[model samples]
Target: MSTVGFVMLCHTALDRAAQVARHWAEQDCPVVIHLDRRVDKASSEKLRSDLKDCGNIRFSKRHRCEWGTWSLVAASQTASEVMLAEFPDVRHIYLASGSCLPLRPVDELREYLKARPRTDFIESVTTQDVDWTVGGLNAERFQLRFPFSWKRNRLLFDRYVELQRRVGFTRKIPENLVPHLGSQWWCLTRQTLSAILQDPARKIHDAYFKRVWIPDESYYQTIARLYSTRIESRSLTLSKFDFQGKPHVFYDDHLHLLRRSDCFVARKAWPQADRLYETFLGPNHRESQMAEPAPGKIDRVFAKALERRTRGRAGLYMHSRFPRLDLENGKTCARYSVFQGFNDLFEDFEPWLSRRLGTRVHGSLFDPVRARFAGDADIYAGCLPATAALRDDNPEMFLTSLIWNTRGERQVFQFSPRDNQRICWFLSTDSNAQISVITGAWAVPLYLSNRDFSDIRKEAALMQKREVEFVNRLRNIGTRADVRVWSLAEFIEEPMENLQSILDAMDGPSAPRLTEAPRMANLDGFGQFLQNLKNQGMKPFVMGDFPATNVEMHQPTGGPRPYLVKK
Candidate 1:
């Protein structure tokens, strides 16, 4: 007869429980099962018939069990008593759930327990030391009355707790009984187990604990400390909980993860996971060497899973986990450049930039008519539509999707006051955005257009107002994007030096110096255009001061200045 016995607490999935119970009996380990009274007689009878061939296994008296209720403690007590009485040779009783499956061979578990015959494996910690709890009372769980089931009577439970707090009501704890909390799954020696079951104070402990919140977690944990000679302060079974205090269920894909735990058993496994059931419960599943249970081996993996569940990947936004605008991990994924006035101030700036950096350059993504995607495609990566109605419906998501879809490639696009200004705040706030602005550059297109001077004045005034507000946002202390701003006159003065600096910041110092510059737009009458706007009662200060009759605007950068040579 095996010295180790298993007492399984089961409620649902009777077929799966029968399989695990038979596995323990086949190893000569006496097994005692406790079925919840809530289960119908037909299902209960079926479970017994399925396991009748295993003579070493027996069923205990049925009792009603519920989450966070005393009935669970009652069921565990009755089941543990039956195990001791039926198996005289059993030295240790391992409490497991129906959903728990053995991760290692039964023989290894038996041998490992046999070596530490008197040791009790249970997690017992004081309330002050407990940190794994998610939301709920800790020490208060023991000090207050909890006759209401949190799951079944949530309103009553909360009202009663609040009432008690308002009236300053607290129950007196029994003497010499310090409350401790731990996982319900534990392994204990027969001497300590029997002492707890047969103690004269058992009635008093039970009466007080009957009204305690989630007594199943604290009953045995607190009692075992009084009788055990050696306590390992941990469970032999592997279990993990999420930040919400819900157990993480194992599926077929987690077979390798369970194996790496090296624990004897794991709970809350999916009942339909046939591969896990077959691989772990099979006869060929034996360990080459018996090692102590070390669930910490996989703690890091669970920690990362929790992080992904809560925060998700940066720059990703979808229907499932669309974080609030202010709470996103990253607004966009990769480093990308935005040109506010470059296109209007330079001829073919988009193609010029593409050639220089070997990157994709797009025109006004926020164009009122349609998105000007690279290569003039109707659709782009991530199947993003170029239609203005769809893109403008939710411009932020459109931008995030584009960046997330083309994560590895650097994106450069044109932005101007003429386009939609909805994404201005988004661009200023995103740290990944590298924005370069040439103020008053919008005037270049107005100057070159054949529109009437009165219309030009009105348009320039509106554009200047929008640009001023945008620049203020960029200059705000809270702004996160890398921002560079220059007036039209300021930029044209040293275009080559400024362009070289921008290239160095993007490509690093290893990039060769600029030997040629992009052709500047004809500004022959640009000074006169500013004068015209000012004369028409609109101030064009954003362009800075320019000589009215100056003819230097046509000169190309990196070329010789006009000189009067003596003939």
Candidate 2:
């Protein structure tokens, strides 16, 4: 007669449960099964017929088990009582769910329990030390009465909790019991198990815990402490939970991950994982040498999975997992440049910057007519189209996709008041954006245009107002971009120095300074144009004070100082 016994609480997948039970029985371990009463008669009959050949396996009294209620605890009690009465030689009772799969050989588990002898393996931690409770009630779960089922009657459950809070209603906990919480699955020594089942105050304990929320998690966990000679505060089975209080189910792909866990059993195995079932339940399952269980080996992998589920991959937005705007882990993946008013100030600025930096430089990406992709292509990286309609439909995603798809290469794009202003706040808030602004440079095109002064003044006023609003956002405390703003007058005074500053920011400190500069657009009449706007009853102070003179205002003072060659 084997000393180890299994008490399985099963509600679904009766075929799989029978297979696991037969494996344990063949290894000389006695098995007691508890099928939930809610299972159909036909399926329950099939389970018994499948396992009928095994002499050591027996079916215990059935009870309807509901999650987070007393019925689950009641089922466990009846099943455990039947196991003790039927198997006199069984010394330890291991509680497992129908979904659990034995990861290690049954013989190895018996030997492991033999070594421990007196130590009970059940996670028993005080309420104060428990941090994994998902619902707000931790210690309160013990203090408050929970008559309503959380899953079936969510409205009543919540309202009752709120009412209890309002009235300060708390149930009195039975004496000699400090509330403890842990996984419902446990492995307890026969002595400790019997003491809990046959204690003189069993009725009082059951009556008090019948109203406790999720007592299965706490009943055995807390009661075992009173009788066990030695207690190891960790479960023998490997069970992982998500950020929400749901078990992580293992599939066929997770075979290697489970093996690395080195646990004897794992809970919540997917019913369809054929590979896992075949490998672990086969006759030759004892491939690994017996070793102490170390479920922590796979903890990092689960933590990463949880992070990916909650925070998601950085800069990756898709139909399946599009996170809310404020909760985005990263707005965009790579560092990209945004030029406000720079293209209007220089000739062939896009191509010139491309050659200078050996990077892709695109014209007004948010242009009102269409996105001016590099080389004027209709389609660009990530299959992003130049259509204004598509881009405008979801501007943030368009920008995020462009950056995510072309992560290895640096991207530079232009923006202006004339283009769509929808992405202003997005650019301002994103730390990945490197923004260089020449305030009021929008006036350069208007200055050179032959349009009537009346129309020019109206458009200039509108553009100035837009630029001012955009600039204020960049200046906001919440703005995270690397922003550098220069008024048109300030920038033109030392164009080369301003250009060098922009280059250093984009390319790091070691990069060579700009030896060749893009040709500055003619701005001889630009200052007079601003004055004309003012005369037309439009204040165009955004461009700052420019001289009415015809001289080149943006030209560097003189050539580099001649250097003597050392012999």
Candidate 3:
């Protein structure tokens, strides 16, 4: 029988790595393990001990792998060479990560490869591929030399890269080499590996690829395409990417998809998601189990109770500039509509809000391009300047309307159209510095060449200036509009408590009876609340809390205090 060789690249989580090694070893396959040199000695020893029983296992010399560098490719090459030398008669070599889980049985895979005889399963695409347009990073990865360590001094490194771009300095691609991008994981025949290792241009390819950024993804795919016409442009490993180009981490929620995918392997799994590992590979495996089970009638009762307790009478509108705050269950208000600019809100979204408000809208003559406020609604719930504009455009709307500020800018002014009417709702932050970091993360990417600290601070300063100008205008128009500010962070931390505060300010109806538990608990407060409930013999129906809107502030703060508000 011609056996298959397995090469697994692992950095951390030795216990999980051991499990993966053992699984493949049990199938009578020869396995080569390459643990990253960065892993501590104790962990490495534990991994060795865990895999000591496997007779077919071999360990490769460790290499310290760095992200977006040639080290990863070096480690992979090291493991492949070891596997080829040890198992000379192996039919095919499968390359994967320690985090990867086998989606199909090993017997099926072995039989399938035996039938194909000479095919390579490698995902390859040219630089002209539409998918490479993500984050506009395809050009930069090939155009310049990223010599500096981005993890250590990201700001300095990005600035240097930008400076190079401005100076019009670019590196040349080697002759007779076309850059092809693809996933690093692949399965190749022994003949293909021998061809790659024995190629006359092997030295030249190595020398050139060492200087390339993220070469692991391109080096093998590019070479495989050049050498083999019998290539399948699909990887056996499955993965996902987010809008920001980060991998969407696999969790229990993705178990169903993994089971259904025809791919042999799946990657980018987290160490903390032990449930996924157990569900797929455990002794009593339950891969079909849903991550979140359907809620029972009791769950619905609690959900309705929480909804009644937290629902606001005033219409909620979120500005495009701010990140939409999600509930703990990853849900946002279903009724809200997003607008690009003030004009977009007035022209496109105003009619939608007017229908929801069911009131006569005034100021039809004002164009959004010329004027700040084109019209007003019965209630405005959004960021500072936009909410302020709603109050200014039609003061009559402010008489009985509510203005809920989501950005938490501090203000000392009171707005009361009548003795008992209060219209202004303030959402203050405990730390303006934190809010700046959050806003900077969202805004700086648009202006800067990359995500560097210097450019982020610069963009944040500009945002702070705009925030101050808007709040100043709001203060000037105060006392006429019943203004009340609530700390946004506080409300996010304690949803039930904060909902009551909002209703109290609006003079809305009393909250419904707290008869049933909530379907979702506040995430930050869940641990403490659950502990308290457990001691009192109670159970929580809710899964998660409202997602916190507060941006975690970092140390070494030296930016302009745009979040500063006058008391």
Q: Which has the greatest TM-score?
A: 2
| Candidate number of the best lDDT | 1
Model 2 TM-score on a 0 to 1 scale: 0.97
Better of 1 and 3 by lDDT: 1
Question: How many clashes in each structure?
Answer: 0, 0, 18
The better-scoring model by lDDT among 2 and 3 is 2
Candidates by lDDT, descending order: 1, 2, 3
lDDT of 1 by residue, 186-246 (tens): 9999999999999999999999999999999999999988999999999999999999999
Each candidate's TM vs. the true structure? 0.93, 0.97, 0.54
- Cα lDDT tens digits, model 3, 1-567, are 545889999987777778878988888888999999999999999899888889989999999988777888888888889888988878789998888877666666787788778888877888888373454568577778777766777887788789888999888876777788887888888878777877898898888778676788888888887677588776767755544456656777766666665556678777677777877666654243322112131334434544543442232433322322322121122111111121111123244333433432223212222223225333334322334455456432332122233223111111111111111122121111001001111121222235654444454445444433433433463322332332223322343343234334333366342222122211233244334433554332222231323233222237542221111
Candidate 2 lDDT by residue in tens digits, 1-567:
598999999999888899899989999999999999999999999999999899999999989889999999998899899899999999899999899999999888988999888989999999989999998988988899999999999999999999999999988888889888898889999999999999999999999898888999899998998899999999989999999999999999999999998899999899989999999999777755888899999999999999999999888998888899778888898899999888898888888899989988899999999999999999999899999999999898899999998989998999999989999999999999999999999999998888998888889889999999999999999999999999988887777778888999888998796767677787666677777777879988877667766535434446772221111
What ranking emerges by TM-score with the best candidate at the front? 2, 1, 3
Error of 2 at 457 (Å): 1.7
User: What is the model-wide C-alpha lDDT for candidate 3?
Assistant: 0.55
Q: In model 1, where is the ten-residue run with the lowest total lDDT?
A: 558-567
Give candidate 3's error at residue 158 in angstroms. Answer: 2.0
